[model samples]
Target: MDHIVIGTAGHVDHGKTTLIKVMTGIETDTTVEEKTRGLSINLGFAYMDLPSGKRAGIVDVPGHEKFIKNMMAGLSGIHLILLVIDAGEGVMPQTKEHIDILQMLGIKKYIIVLTKVNTVDEELVELVVEDIQEQLEGTLLEEAPIYKVDSLSGTGINELISKIDEESQKIERSNSLVSPRMHIDRVFSVKGFGTIVTGTLIEGTLHVNDELIIFPKELRTKIRNIQVHEKNVNEASAGMRVALNLANVHVNDLSRGDTLASSGSVQKTWMIDVKAALLPHAENPINLWDRLRLYIGTREVLCRAVPIGVERLEPGEEAFLQLRLEEEIAAKKGDKYILRSYSPMHVIGGGVILDTLPTKHRRFNEHTIETLKTREKGSTSELIADFMNRKEDLLTSMEETASYLGMPQTEVIEYMGEMVKKNQLIKVHQLYMSSLKYEKLKKDITAILDRYHKSFRLRTGITKEELRSRVASNVKSKDFDKLLQLLADEKVIKNHETISLSEFTVTYNKYQLKDKEDIEQKLKKAGFTPPSELELIGDNKERKELIDSLTGKTIVRLDSETVMFKDYYEEAVQKVINFIKQNGKMTLAEFRDMTGSSRKYSMIILECLDKNKITKRVENFRLLY
Candidate 1:
């Protein structure tokens, strides 16, 4: 865990800023516009040393309705919040709106403060406190302890600070294990420094000199320096307010919505899949293709909500949605977001991101909805299993799985070890094929071999490359090889130079047996020079197929224009061996005279011998291999 951040939220004139000024002695509202209006216009930052000896960072957000956008940005990474309310007026409109935003953002820890108690009598203060407590019911702050205070006199401020310190000590965040990411809420240039950006370190740790990239722009940069609470630091972790001096970028090129993260950690995308819910108090239901403004991690983009498995979403109902955006934003799975009406610009609903990148989904698709539901609520194991099962035909790599599931590669790898143990996944080298897919592939192999054998009974088997192209083309070559070996070991299939069913064998049918004898007799009669396959079969397609099946098995096709019976081919081989041994070598002309054949036939036989390595050709003569 790193530093704990605290934020202020309430309506205007709630004394939220004054309470902070009394505690930290640093006025957050420094701008002339803010001073002149007597209201915080932009986000302000201050830090205070807690009684527990830790410096807690504070964000003072503008309470005015017009600055709700800034308020939402300030609230983005804080672990706890101080929901201040004046004792004079309790539970105002903006107060309720802030509470709604806080709840929608899924913040859990809150400390309700009832400020300016001196302006009213004790009875009225008690009445306001009761009203505030009643409004807090069924909200996140229901159990939160409220403190009565007067920021002007500094009364009851010490107790509030002590409570904040107590709560901050209980915070536990994963700052060390994950990659660092920060959304830039402020971008400016100092006198000597280059572009500097400030935001809360949402996760992981950032170090000086660490190379990073600004997302949506994809401009690479290095961290020149790091600062926390006006003090230079070598490193900063999650939950702390951080300012980074970046190299190789200009202030004008940066903006408030840009994200700074470890390079390759995030990809900019317009479409995102999420489990979204419309607020119960929303003015109207959200229909498909209704353009809405999306806010996540201080970045806002316009998008259209295409509800999955439904045409429109009623208030308070949760469903899977594919948001099609007008522009791109970089986000990760599980990040919370808020959606505002395009024209009115009020918070209508919010959700947690399920997939940073996803293809456009069809409306009312059961498979899409089911898969998204698993992503929304399934465990790590369930998520992994569901993903592999859904993409059963693909060879999913660990890196690809981790990116889609929004998990660390090491974490996904660890879970994969367990998945293989449980027999849920079939791991082949660096890839994973689902156990279900393996079974289906095994079945397909047997079925394909069966069909091939029934169609051509006198052939050996299908080639390995042909089988793989039909069954596992998307699988890696090495992975498919290993799968063949596994299938062979399991007795599901036979793996050789060519793959086949374990029980498949070449056998001739009755008609093919008759054709085989007839063909052999004809070849024997022809002796040294047999008719070509085309001449023998003529137009008999079945006989032609039978002869083709006998190739490399029973009868040998000497050339495109010739064929030889197995015995005659062997007799020719012996004749070559004897002739070569007797005469050391024999020219094609001499072999023609010995076989009593023409030059063309003699050349074909000698060429076949040369190909079979029974004889080697030297110029125009043949010699024993």
Candidate 2:
């Protein structure tokens, strides 16, 4: 069955809650203060059965300007809005505010309800309708049906119900039957039921015995029972006013603005990107870096509003804004938000959440502005994919990515897992590296190696850590190692201990052979006290040519500190082995005595031999193995 949420919006005493009570026979306002004051101060929810056997949830929001925050909480996830106007008062201040807020929130469908018809004459009602018709010009309600109703006398109430029923039949059925979410606008305890929280189910299905997590608090509990429209239901789904009888929670632990979701599905995010607007009657113009109260899906948080593409956003203007919140919030892509000024609070404007978790955006940059604009125009999936593609580093996990994208982690993970199964992307741990990235990494490493050989010929290759640090520092340490291992597995690169290269051995062309011979002759003639690679290649192409030719060859060994010629190294090793054979163990001075070389050279060659598994070096002696 198709389920639709219809919410009422207008000024206080406009009969929003009373109209709902009369239509659905369910009083939404359960608060003592609301009933005593004869005004709703929080969100009140009720549901009615349509003529077509469909069900529609009704959210009766507090219409007083002081409780506008409550109205914002009620408006989220609503498919249809009922903008209630008092026929006797014509158009009031909050009536206009509510209308502007609904427009900014992107409510496309609504039916305007003119209440208190019994208190006014037909001529006055016509004038009120004319004024409303003029005000709703160019808005969502431009052509919507307007109903005149008096809830007190039961006049036009039945007609309003029939209109809602007709509209409910036209509402499209949702395909999503995943885990359920109910943004709690009301929470209280009943005598028999432990802690019952009520709200319109925004998504998924909830049944008895289902585990749920209540957010910002993150409390986990099972559904002891379920009630929809004051009656017991085996299962509740999206667009139903549900009261969940939580198994193990207290009323104090529960509050308004908390969300009930299937366990381990929703995530918290401190940063988000949105496309917000200023309300028409905002007290002040919003400047760059101004702070505002962000009301989204029953949660109100203080967020720093960074105006994108402009230095200031005037009233009634729309712009992309980045909301840097003080606390983490549970929000999904396509969720509507209502923004109010921080001081002398008033509803300014609200828009959709584009990216749930965004890095701080650059101020007023055209490219960044254009990107955010594109994200604003993109679909939920497209925005998610674009967010992933724009990241310089791999997303650490699908869960994190989904949070970053303001999408349900399950939805993104399912789609991403399918893509991986299709070989479009690769996963290492929770990080996703695109197949294109893997291929690019392969090509880049090969190019780096090829360039390295051209620049310094005396080095065998580069260390894995060095290459990783230089090529992409953002790659996670473990994933970098994993990528190197994957490269080795694919034979894209060869790993010799920590040293890695595209090719295992260096090739010897005629030019390289000549260069190697020249360096060898220079080292041998100098009696193994050869010049450093930099010294030989000092500011001259000839020297560079020589070092490049002998890289990775037996002729020159690039050790930790110094370079040793193959012949010199062999002579030194043979002298050490001979001394060890003659003396069983030779002291360092004795080995120095055998090589007749400098202390540094002898020590370096000894360490090189030790590293090569040919000899063991101790405090004062060497042992041939």
Candidate 3:
């Protein structure tokens, strides 16, 4: 069953409160001031069982002009609107303003309820209905079903309730796959319960004992209890009006507009990029640096609107804007917001947020404008690609990217997997890069290797550190290791202790080859006690380079003073293993006698065996490693 929150909107004293009472049999105006003044001052909530057995939450908003902000606060989670118009007064000023707000905030459905039909004659009632129908032209409510009822007499009330039930089924259920987030509109402390917050569960599910973070302040807390329509439940689903009992928190620490969400999901921002437009009858154009009142998700903030790609946004003109906020807010992409004049708060315009986390963009930046347009209109996959392409060479992680896109990490990974197959994205180990960036990086690596090979023909490869510093220094160590190994697997590069192009090899002139062969023969002839490196180098620098290149491949450099040919080194390793296997251990004297070498040579060779893990030294002997 779809959990729906329906909100009441219209002029003051339009019978909104009494209508809710007639529908739900519950008095919504519970505050003493409201009872005394006979007007709603803040939000009032009630629920009723519809014919379909779906419990529809009813939010009663203050219709007075002074409390319009309070009205906006409760309407954030509403799926439908009860646009109340007085039968005697027809369409009032606040009714018009409320309709504008509803349209701007993206309320998809509304049922026009004309109250106090008993007080008006049949002709007057028909005239009022016709006037409202004419007034609703060019709006989402133009074709809305209008019902005339008298709350005091309970006339036509059942028909309105049935219509509401029918419309409630039309509401698109909130997605439970997204991370849960709720903007706290009320926070108070009960005597036994620590901190209790009331709001609509906007998306996902909140379970008892689930860890939560309040954004904009980021106060950490846990859910101790969950309630929907005042009944405790193990979990609350999206679109339900929720009252959360929060543990380890205080009423003073939280306030209205603080978002309760899973940690690292919803972001806090002091700036946002949006596609803003003005109401058709707006009084003034939006000028640059115009301080405006921004109402988003129950939070009212002071912000400066810097128009993009235009100097001033006239009435009914659409433009991109970067709203520089005075206070931080927890917002996500596609959240609709209302804009009001800074001093006297009246709805001037509103638009949907395009980017919650955006840099301060200068006016008239074509690229920035293009990006905003795409983000506002593009599909989800396009949005991901656009965001990734903007990152240049940086490898994006799933958590951060999902947070920015306002999606679950698992869901983003699914989209990313498809993109990878389409060659639109590249998965480099655990990180993500745009295919454009990946191709550039691949080309850069190949060019660097080409230059290195040409610059130093005798060198086999470049150190891994040098390659990383040139390719992308910010790449994590483990990611870089995986990247190099991947390149080697693709046959684009060869990775060992160092990295090189797959086709790269050390080359030597005929004279240098003679010196390399001469060094190899000397080491082979001096098998038991190979000549030292310096002895082999003698006076030739090129001989030293050739000998150094042969170290780990054809020669095992035992120490600075001792070296051995690869074959002799293998023979000595086998001898130590054979002796240890038969005699259990071998001493330096035994090896010296066995090989007919001196004590110095024997000690060096034994120590070399220990270094190579061919043998382990006991007290005066060696054992097989």
Candidate 4:
């Protein structure tokens, strides 16, 4: 059966509680204090079955001014509202306040109910109806039907039930794909049960044994049992008043403002960005950085409202704002919140959240304001695109993006796949980058290689580490490697131990050619006992540069003080092979004698042969491998 929540809203002694009892045949007021005083001080829950067989959960909220917070707690997850008004008194202060709150909370469906109609004359009842119609002229209830009913006598009750059934058929059930969110309005302990918390399931579905986290505290617990409308159920979907018997959670640890949600679905944040509007009946203009009480999803927190791009927000004016909260709250984009004055404790303004997790923004920053505007008004894909574009060169993971946007990771991955297919985003090693940023990185890499080629014309290329240090040092090593491979595949650059422009090649000038020749001759004449690099260069900067160029090109091999030309090194290898073949195994002294070189040169040559795997030292002798 489809489940819908109908919340009562009105003034003190307006018969909201009494009206609910007559209609549902279930007494909502169960607290001793409420029963003794004949006034509800906390939220009450009951359910009724309509003639059409639809189950409707009823939330009877306290109407006294001091218990407004308690009333606000019951307002979350409501699909339909029953605005109860006293026929004898017409509209009162709390009545108007409740209307303002309902509107601010984004409630669209409602039916105005004039209770205690039998206490007033027919003429007075008609006048009260006219007054209600006038007050609802510009609100969501302007076209709503107003019914007169006496709760005690059940007068006009059947007509009201029929209307409710008709309206319930039109209201769509909440989407089960959204993450499950239940705001705890009441937390208490039953004799046999561990800890029981009751609230309306606003979204998704909760099943037995489901692990959930209570926000702000982030206490982890599991659902031991589930009850909907006072009956055991294996699962409860959105729009049902549910009492969850929780395991590993103490009643003392649970609070009314706490929200139970699927793990990783909600996050606690101390700051949020929103598109806010001050109510027309606000008592004072909201200046920049004004402290206020923020109410959202049954949570009340103290926060400061900072108007974006303006000094103050006048009554009824809408603008972007950043709320700096004094405590963390679990909130998300599109969640509606009410703002009340800190001292006067009256509803002043409210708005929908644009960003649940946001960095501290500077007031009047044009870019920040423009970004917020896009978030407020853009489509989902557009918002994701903007988020990626803002990241620029930094690649964002899907998890990070999902957390930032307050969406599920699976949803974010789906969107990212679409973006990648459209070429609007680039995916490298599971990291995402905007197309613009990818192009910029490619360009920067090309420029860096071009500069390196120009500076070292006599060398092959720069080392990969050096290239990375110069160009993409901030990029992750794995991601940078993937990017380099991509560039190599595109023939934009060449990747080896070193990176260089694809078309780049080392060229030797006349001076460099002469120096290279001179160095080759010196190493060749010295044979295996070549002069040390310092001795060969003799402080000649040009010679040193030439030596470095030759070594970089693999034209010269240097091992400590010994240097060997490539061709000569090949010849030495051949000689060693010949000696080993002829003698089977040769001692180091015998090798030195055969090489016709000094002990130092012979030792270097033997070491090089050993390193190249040409020969192995077997104690007193060397053997060719």
Candidate 5:
């Protein structure tokens, strides 16, 4: 069953709270001050059983001119709204402002309930209804049914409830089953329940014994119990007004704007990306980097609006924006937010979050703007896929990705699994990246190595760490490792504790300028001791530099950090291969006996041949592969 929250909005003392009381026999105004003053000062809650047997939560908001902020908080979580206008007075200042705010908040499904109809004549009530029609002409409620009700007389009270049920039944139920995130609109302590927080569970499920994290303060607590409309339940789903009995958090640590969520799932964010359009009838223009008040889910934050691709957001113009907030907020992508001017507190426009965790962007950045537009422009599933594809490395945290995609992580996990089976992408652990990026990285590394081989023909292969440093400009570490592994899988590169090019080779056409016989005699007498390349060059200055360059390239090493020239390695390889062929496989003792060298020299020569893959070292014996 869908958990729907219904809220009332209209001018001050317009019978919003009174109508709720008549419909549900529960006085929403709980405070003595509210009863004495005969006006609601804060939000009130009431619930009723619909004919469909689904329980709907009623949030009664204050209609006074001074309590619009409180009204915004109450209406933020409502799935369907009741715009209660006084029949006698028709639309007043606060009534129009409340209606404009509801439209700006992106409240699409609403019913116009003309309250206090019994206080006015029937003909006058019809005129008031016509006036409401004009007020809602271009908004979401233009076609909404107008119900006349008098809370004092209880007239049309049943009809209002029926209409709420009828409209709520039409809304499609969301299937998200992730960790719960409830924006706390009311925080107080119940005598035995400890600290209880009440609000709409906007996403996921809440259950007893679930560990939760309250954001901004990030206090950890466990849900001792769950309550829906004063009734205890084992589990609570999204769209329901719930009160969570917290085990550890105190009442003073939490407030109205704070959010309670499952630990490790939701992170507090200080910046968000949005795709917003200024209201065409906005009183003032919104300039780039303008400061504004952002109201999202039940939290109001002061934010700097950095417009994307436009310096000044003219009336009716849409653009991507990065909002730098003064306080941390728990917001997801695609969540609607109302943006208001800081001073006048008038709703300038509203927008949907495109990127929850975003870096600051400069104006007129075409690519970033276009990308945000795609997320704002596409359907929910399409946007999710696009966001995952852009991440490139599937290694990004699932929680972060969910926040970036503006959906519950559980929903993303389910859809990601489907996408993976369809060959759209892959998930390793909790991170996701496009399979295309994985393949492209391999091709890029292959191209890089191919270029290095062509340019530096003298070197055997480059070091792996050095390659990573060089490729950092183009590829990230996670992506680089992923590509290297892919290349190794395809046998395009060889991994020897380090990555090496597949076709890399050492050439000595120039190094063999001296006679082979003369070099061998010199190296054999040196006996594990090799002359420096420059010292062996005698008087040729050009030849000295050339041989010196070969010192680091294709050279051989032995124990004690001793180095041998490439010419020596070449000679020793041939000798070792010939010995292996003649004797099938020679032991170290037999090899040393044949070579007429010391144990150290014998071991060094044997190891050099092993390093070059000329022979395999096994205990005391060597074998030719």
Candidate 6:
């Protein structure tokens, strides 16, 4: 069944509650305070079965000036408005304010209702209708149908009901395939249910035992039961007014304006980019950095608006703005929001969210403004590409993209596959990066290696750790390794223990070459007993560089004061292995005698062989494994 919410908007004592009571046969106002004061202080709900066999949810919003915040909360999921105006008093102050709010909130469908018709004369009724028509000129409700009804006497009630049923049939149901999102408007502890939260499901579906996250606090809970229209249900979909009994959360932890959503489906952000317009009836021009109250979904947060490329926003002007919120909120692209002044608290302007998570932008940055404009009007693929491009240094996964875009993972996977096939995105392992970012990283890697080669002429290449730190520190280790391997496969770079450009090779000057040859010959002739540092170019920086280069190439070993040539080290290793294979094991003293060297040299060679895993030491004897 298609579920739609019709909300009441008008001034206090305009008979909104009475009209709903007579129409639905359910009294919305249940609180003692409301009955005693004869005014609503919070949102009250009821259900009306239309003549078309469709059920519509009724949200009766408080119309008093002090409770407008509560009214704003109830307006988030409304599909149509029942704007009430008392025929005796036409449009009052709160009535005009409510109209302004409805305009700002982007509610275009409504039915003008003139209540208390029996209390006014026929001429007064016609005059009031004329006054309402004039007030609605150039507004969303300009062409809305007008009906004068006396709820106390049941006059014109049947015609109003038929009209509402006709309008309800025209509204399309929300898609259930999108991730579920519900902004909590009421939270309480039921006698036997423990904790329950009620709201209108905006999208997707919620089932019993479904895990959900309360955002901004990220509290995890499961649905113990689901209820719609005071009856139990196995599952509920988008556009339904639902009450969920939560399993693991307490009533004290929940509050009005908190959002319940599918895990990882939405993100809480402190900054957003918007396309806003100041209302023509605004009393004051909105200056840059002006603090205002931002309302989206059921959330109301304090924020400062920084107008793009302008000093002050004159009344009736549209501009791009960056809103820095005082608290975090979970929102998505295309979500509507309303801004009210901080002091007098009247609706000033409203807009759609262009980017939910955005970096701080300069006031007059043309590129930023252009990008936001493109995102606002872009296609799904374009928006995904823009999201990837913004995360330049990090690889975005398909799951992450789904969450950021408020899309399902399966759909995101399909889009990503298409993007990869078109070469618009590069898939490295399971992570994704825009083609532009991949190309830029490739260039950066080459440049880093080129600089490293120039700075360290004696070194073979930079270590893998060093290269990653310089070029791809933000990338995951596995993803970074895969990227490097991919580069190596393309022959664009070489990778081993170190990474270097495929075209790069170590080169030496004439003097350095001569010194390297000298050192090699000396070590080669020394056999198993190599000379100490003091015996060969002691404390010389040039000779030290040569030693480091040789070690890097694995041509020599610099162990403390001992320097062993690679050839001799291999010889010693073979001897020990042969001795152990023949005798099953060899002792340190026996190895010393066999190599014809002192204990110091024998121990050093034995330790080197052990380090290389050529032999394992058991007690005082060494055994080959």
User: Which candidate number would show the highest TM-score if scored against the true structure?
Assistant: 3
The candidate, 1 or 2, that scores higher on lDDT is 1
Q: Tell me model 4's lDDT, rounded to 2 decimals.
A: 0.85
Off by over 4 Å in 2: 175-179, 262-267, 280-283, 378-382, 389-432, 435-491, 495-500, 506-625
TM per model? 0.74, 0.69, 0.84, 0.76, 0.75, 0.80
lDDT of 5 by residue, 1-625 (tens): 5578888988888888888878788998898999999999999999888888878899998888777778888985678888888898988988877877787677778888888888889999888888889877887788888888888988988888888888888876653555567788988898976898888887777788988788878888998998888889999887888888899878888899888877655656899888787888788778766889988878888988777787777887787778889988976666788888998777788878777656677667777877777777776556656665555333455565565664666677787777678766655444565666556656767787888777655445566767877654444565556656756777889765445577565455644544333444564567545654544556755443333334444345553344565565676667768888987888877766765666777777788667767789887789985
Q: What is the per-residue lDDT of model 1 for residues 263-323, given as tens digits with 9 covering 90 to 100? A: 6567688888988888888898889889998988887789988889887889989878899
> After superposing candidate 4, which stretches have Cα over 4 Å from the reference?
389-418, 428-431, 436-484, 490-625
Question: Alpha carbon lDDT of residue 595, candidate 5?
Answer: 53
Candidate 4's clash total is 0
lDDT of 2 by residue, 1-625 (tens): 5668898988889888888888888987897888899999877777777877777888888988998888888876788888888999877889888887888777778898999999988998998899989987987789989999999999988888888888777666542444567788888898976788888787777889988788867888899889876689898777667788898899999888888886545657888878877766677888877888888888889988778777888887887878888988876666788888788787778888877657787877787887787787866545545656656675456755654454556778887887788766777776887777677778888888778767655556776777887777888778888888888888777776444465656556686677667677777775545566676555666656456435445455547335656777777777777777888897766766666766766666677788888888676777886
Scanning candidate 1 in windows of ten residues, the lowest lDDT window is 170-179
Better of 1 and 6 by lDDT: 6
* lDDT of candidates 1 onward, in order: 0.85, 0.76, 0.87, 0.85, 0.75, 0.87
Rank list by TM-score: 3, 6, 4, 5, 1, 2
TM-score of 4: 0.76
Compute the lDDT of residue 550 as modeled in candidate 2.
Answer: 57
Give the candidates in order of lDDT, highest first. 3, 6, 1, 4, 2, 5
The per-candidate count of clashes, in order, stands at: 0, 4, 0, 0, 4, 0
Candidate 3: segments with Cα more than 4 A from true spot: 391-393, 397-415, 429-431, 443-478, 489-492, 502-552, 555-625
Q: For candidate 4, write residues 1-625 as lDDT tens digits.
A: 4889999999988999889989988888897888999988988888899999989999999999999999899999999999999999999999999999999899889998999988889999999999999988998889989988999988999999999999998887775656788888888899998899999888778999999999889999999999988799999998889999999989999888899987766658899899888998898988877889999988899998888888888998998889999998987678899999999799888989987768888888999988898899987678777777765346877866775565666888998999899988888988988888788888988888788778777666787777778767788888888888988999998887578899987678887777778888887787767788888777676676566567735455547555677776777788888988998988878877776878877888888888879999998888998
Better of 2 and 3 by TM-score: 3
Which structure is stronger by TM-score: 1 or 5? 5
**lDDT by residue for model 6 (1-625), tens:** 4678899999999999999999999998899999999998999999989998888999999999999999999987788999999999999989988888898778878999999999989999999999999988988999999999999999989999999999988877675777889999999998988999999998888999999899889999999999999899999998899999998999999899999998767768999999998988799988888999999989899999898878888889998899999999988877889889999888888988888879998888889878987887877788888988886455888877876776767888899999999999889888898888888888999999889888877776788878888878888778889888978998989886578889887677999889888888898887777887567666567787577567646465646666777877777888888888888999999988887777888888888778767787899999985
Superior candidate under lDDT, 4 versus 6 = 6
